[model samples]
Target: MSALVEVSELRTWFDARQGGKRCVVKAVDGVSFAIHRGETLGLVGESGCGKSTAGRTLMRFHNPNGGRILFDGNDITSGDIKPYRSRMQMVFQDPYSSLDPRLAIRDIVAEPLNIQQPKLPAAERDAVVVENMRLVGMNSEALSRFPHEFSGGQRQRISIARALTTNADFLILDEPVSALDVSIQAQIINMLMDIQERSGITYLFIAHDLSVVRHISQRVLVMYLGRGMESAGTDELYAHPLHPYTQALLSAVPTPDPKISRKKQRIVLEGDVPSPINPPSGCVFRTRCRYAESRCADSVPEMRDAGGGHFVACHRYE
Candidate 1:
């Protein structure tokens, strides 16, 4: 399969004033990865580790401070983003805030069509909204209702409908199921998978939950402090996580099987996440990594293929 989206050395930085000192907050620093067509690439990390920033940068919502963004082999970062708008779409985390309260559901879902595919007539637009709503398991009853009238899960379905209005095959799902209740999360996740199966859509699913990522993703990429710690196929990464951070994350995910649950060793990390504005030198995770040595603090680790295409950015991997 070919890459539907390719990001290389992507960086998104912000200027912040901390006690009168101007500093750069490296929200996403030098991140690189590729998303193949029809596969869900899960991006997992702790809070403020640039997962959301990377998603936004890929969607071209936040202009990258540095790096290349190629969408279907075209350089989208440097050129006009208008053409990319129709082919790619984003589903946000909060359904309540993402939708318009003032507009009816039909109007809300059709908003993207108005912006991205205005050539479609009103009848076609209505047809597209209806089909997408149905695809997301939303009935025609929701077409006339307001956002506040629906549950969290239903609102998220509406959000999904809006994203699909532009007929996008590539979606940036940024914490799409996080805000919902655990019971509701499964429905949304399952629906996303079903949609992918039917439409062959490619997704960059960003979430903090390792379990959720493992369920929906074909490959997983772990990030820390805006840097990619490791990336591999889903089962491979979980079974044998190379990076300390990846190991700690996987160890925390609760296993359902009794035997595995009993044998799993929880890796409890110490210390607070470093400030993005003034990150530690060398490996960003050295402060919390139990396997850290003097060499870990001397230089940054370049991502290298450990084996079988598993890439890890840790000195220990050598």
Candidate 2:
């Protein structure tokens, strides 16, 4: 199957001034991946690892500093995103902040239609809003309510409803469940999966929750300090993670089976993540990697395929 979205050597940077000097923070640097039509690709990393930035960049919410973005085989790197807005949508991380407090639920859900189809009749727009709300497990009865009346989970459902109002084929779900309760997270994840099955929508699921990623993603890409560390089929990556950073992350996920938990060895990484503005040369993870060698500091390790489509960026594999 062809990729629905392809990003090559993507980079998104931010300019800042520190100590009276200009500096560039490489929020996302040299990352590449593809999301097949109707498939979910999980992007996982620690906080500040640029997963969110990558998602925003893909949506053209942030202009890329370098590289290319292709949507359904058309280059959309530096063009007006208005044309693609309806086809691509995003569910932001914070449900509380994402929704407009001033708007009623009906208006919030119909806002996209108003923008994309300005001439759409009010009755038709309201029908679309109710339909989308039903798709996200919402009722039309809540249409007149304000955002403040809903709980975090309901607010998130509203966000999802709003994203689907335009019938987007691809969704950038930036930690959509991270802010909700553990039980609510499962509900939201299941709803998303159900929606995908019904609509054949593709998703770029970004989150730090390894277990959740493993549950929903067909493939997983691990990131650290704006660079990709490893990527492989979800089962393959979890079963045999090659990169030290990947290993450490997997180790931190708690297991339900006491026997397995007792037998598992956790890999603790030392030192904090290096500043993106002054990221170390060569391997960005070398500073905290236990298996780091002198040569690891010489240059960034090229992503190498170990076997069966599993790829890791670590000199040790070479």
Candidate 3:
């Protein structure tokens, strides 16, 4: 199938005021990727690597400084996002902070429908909310309670219910299970998989955890300093990571078997991640990479087709 969402060289920058110096922080600088219909595209990176920012930009939460965002064959990089809000939804990382304490569970879940389709009857909207709640494994009685009354997992379920109420085909799941318990995380992940099976929703799953990304993603995109490092099939990327940053990342995912874990060669990268403001020349990840050379510093590497449909952005890979 063709891409449902196509983003080309998307850039979202922010001005930072540090002491007396003013500088532009490239939160999402020249990033590009696509999300096909009915597929989960995992975007993995370290904290403050602009993974979340990319997701928000795609959802039009932030006005991109440059490039285009095409959704469903139309350019939606500018103008009012209200028309597409219902078709695209975002479930935030923190369930506690995302939901409003003032509103009851039922009201919170039905908010999208109420905003987008205000003319709908009260009973009909309530039914739609309840059905969405059911899809996320939520109890009907809990709808009367506030967000604070439920557990972290339950609150997240309510959040998911709210996103689903609009029948959004594209969902940006930004670390949706990061805040929940391990067992609860599995439950939510399974629920998401079930939702995909039933509704064929396209997902841009962003997370720092490689293991979680591996579980639900068919394709994975690795990011560093707001730029895409590599993107390939989940198994392909994990088995043969082309970028050094990706190799270092995959090395950290813990293995279940004692023997395999013991024998595993962890690629411990050195140095702190460079700031987005005044990032290293040529390549952002070059400072910490072991394979950095004069060529790596001289010019930025473009994404190259590295056999078997895998794409990598590294001089060494090129």
Candidate 3 per-residue lDDT over residues 14-126, each given as its tens digit: 99887789989999988889889999999999988999999999889899999999999889999988889999999998999999999999899999899999999999999
C-alpha displacement of 255 in model 1, angstroms?
Answer: 0.4
Q: 42 in model 3: Cα distance from truth in Å?
A: 0.3
In candidate 2, what are the lDDT values of residues 1-318, reduced to their tens digit? 999999999999999998999999999999999899999999999998999999999889899999999999989999888889899999999999999999999999888778899999898899999999999899899999999999999999999999999889999999999998999999999999999999999999999858878888999999999999999999999889889999899999999999988999988867778889999889999889888888988989998889998999999888
lDDT of 1 by residue, 21-135 (tens): 9989999999999999999999999888999999988878889999999999999977689888889999999999999899999999999899976788889889999999999
The local distance difference test score of each candidate is 0.92, 0.93, 0.92
Please give the lDDT score for candidate 1: 0.92
RMSD of each: 0.9, 0.9, 1.0
User: Alpha-carbon error at 184 in model 3, in Å?
Assistant: 1.2
The residue pairs in collision within model 1 are none
Question: What 10-residue stretch in candidate 3 is worst by lDDT?
Answer: 269-278
